[model samples]
Target: MAKRQPRDTLPTHIAQWRDQVRRDYGIEDAPGLILLEQAALALHRAEQARELLAKDGLVTRDRFDQPKPHPAAVIARDAEASFRAALRDLQLDVEPARPVGRPPGV
Candidate 1:
């Protein structure tokens, strides 16, 4: 019998997702990580769904004539929505507030 190898847990951690977001978005600040973390799980699922759809051409229904989005596409769509919403909610974090008053210690 073959010995079972330990499963890699990197994919399940938030830091991994954070790293992915950084690489994907070329983010350089903590705010970007924070935003991605908000929708980490959904983003991960969306990526997985996209990969599945790309590779398998998954068609949930073959008996019907009407064309429809693949199940993976649906998952990707919902996940993308969640990801975008998270980013939208954190827009302020990405754009720093400008100081309206005079310079300090002028």
Candidate 2:
């Protein structure tokens, strides 16, 4: 059997960094807010790429494959939302998602 990769690594890092940054800056929201905003943008770009790939029929799998958002996009959005929610819980302002324009051919 293949060994499973650890799932909690990134979240652990994020939480550790968030705490460190908070302590260093003496501000509750400084770095966490920034990280969340960055993560959100990454997610948006990833989602766009996934849409593009799907439109172009580049990704395929057997019928038994459960449909999922393209991996990168899913990771990005999940990370972004998780961080954003954390920031919100701490009362930080999070930028909303901007609408993406249609692709050139569409």
For each candidate, give its TM-score against the true structure.
Answer: 0.49, 0.34
User: What tens digits encode model 2's per-residue C-alpha lDDT throughout 31-79?
Assistant: 6566544544444554555666667555445578965445554554665
Displacement of the residue 51 alpha carbon in candidate 1, Å:
1.0
Model 2 TM-score (2 dp): 0.34
lDDT (0 to 1) per candidate: 0.72, 0.56
Clashing pairs in 2: none
For this target, which candidate reaches the highest TM-score against the unseen true structure? 1
Best by lDDT: 1
Position 21, candidate 2: lDDT: 49
lDDT of 1 by residue, 1-106 (tens): 9999883233656557567667876877777666667677667778888999989786655566666668888889998888778877655344477898988997
Could you tally the backbone clashes for each prediction? 0, 0
- Residue 75 deviation, candidate 2, in Å? 3.6
